[model samples]
Target: MQRTFKSKIGILTHILLLITIILLFYSMWIKSIVFLVIMLIINVLFVPSFIHTEYIFNNNMLYIKSGYLPVIKIKLDTISEIISHPKKNSLFTTNPTKRYALSSDQIILYCKDNRRIAISPYDKEGFIRETIKCNPDIKISE
Candidate 1:
């Protein structure tokens, strides 16, 4: 079975992003409307990716995507451990395929191949529970 969950996007984050975008666009218009229009279109297109995200945990694969970003497939077999707190974990950004999140609570996944990725799921506990089911060898730290 595949468990699907939404990303940890808070309302306050969205509101702040919207306000910043509006202010930037308004200010840019003073110089040139063309610049503002082009940048506005680009920025507006990315709003969905920041606001909408879904993660799917299947038998051995975890599929995740934020907005229009490419879907990343993570094999449970490659995961060595998971850390609950982000600060304690020195997250590595070397993974070719990784997720960038905007939530306060994040889980750091350490792969057996020495790669690390940070993930933010709305249901952090449930996500860990399901991940353990897939990879029994995976260890979790508080």
Candidate 2:
């Protein structure tokens, strides 16, 4: 069985994004309807791509895949730790800032070489339990 975890943009966040897009389109200083339209289109297109993610554990390895640009996969044995913590900034951005992964659900996976991957699981507790069951040696912090 393939387990999937989808990260959803909160309703409030989506509303805020729409309002921002409208305001940007209406603003005379940066009056570029085309730009605003393009942004809106991109945002709408991007949401669905992130709505479904899959994590497969098989043959002593774990695979994490998303329906977004630049797919990713991680091996289970290489994972050093799994931490449940709030991130400060959006994961899509390169800037380092504090942002919550999910308002109420977040996890940070640290790899063996110090690489970190953050995810906002839909069912945080269940995911944790399942992860632990798969890799008992992996550390988990609540």
Candidate closest to the true structure, highest TM-score = 1
Clash pairs for candidate 1: 49-67
Write the residue-wise lDDT of candidate 1 on 1-142 in tens digits: 9898777876766886787587667868687777677767767776777777778988789887777777878899998999887664355442535655556567888888777777778899898889988899998886
Computed on alpha carbons, the lDDT of every model, listed in order, comes to: 0.77, 0.60
The top-ranked prediction according to lDDT is 1
lDDT of 2 by residue, 1-142 (tens): 5565555456665676666656656653587878777666765765444444555555656566555545566667777788776444534442222222333355777779767776666677777777777678888765
What C-alpha lDDT, on a 0 to 100 scale, does residue 90 get in candidate 1? 56
Provide the lDDT at 37 for model 2.
76
TM-score of each: 0.80, 0.65
Q: lDDT at 60 for candidate 2?
A: 59
- In model 2, what is the error at residue 45, expressed in angstroms? 4.9
